[model samples]
Target: MGIKVNLDEMLHQRRMTLTELSGRVGISLTNLSILKNGRSKGIRFSTLSSICSELDCEPGDILARDHSSLEGED
Candidate 1:
């Protein structure tokens, strides 16, 4: 994937569990897991907003470009 989710790192740094984030964001564990595990195809901006709000982070803190994945592109 070209985009990497830094969710686990953020959660660890914040001393919070995924379950707690789910509750705070009002999102399901399964959905957050999909995102955390980098298995998601996409994310809704509202969902991203809610997560950022709870985690006290910017979108860049959660998402980053996988520069290695762009190695073959022009």
Candidate 2:
């Protein structure tokens, strides 16, 4: 496990669609889709800022620590 994106849940809680978020965030649907699905390798702070602003949430709300993998590291 790694950093898990919580975009799906946040979108659902806001009753907003990906399409709508894309428009508001000025990000392409394809890119947003990738991020939303947790398939993105990374995200720029500007993009993240836009998303957080539009969604009315913080980065912590959209990203969560996946501690399961840490247990085996040591």
Cα misplacement distance, residue 3 of candidate 1 (Å): 0.1
Spell out the clash pairs found in candidate 1.
Answer: none
- lDDT tens per residue, model 2, 1-62: 58889999999999999999999988999999999887888999999999999989999999
lDDT (Cα) of model 1 = 0.93
Each prediction's total of clashing residue pairs, residues at least 3 apart in sequence or on different chains, is 0, 0
Relative to the unseen true structure, what is the C-alpha lDDT of residue 4 in candidate 2, on a scale of 0 to 100? 82
lDDT tens digits by residue: candidate 1, 1-74: 28889999999999999999999999999999999998998999999999999989999999999877766643
Q: Name the top lDDT candidate.
A: 1
lDDT of each candidate versus the true structure:
0.93, 0.90
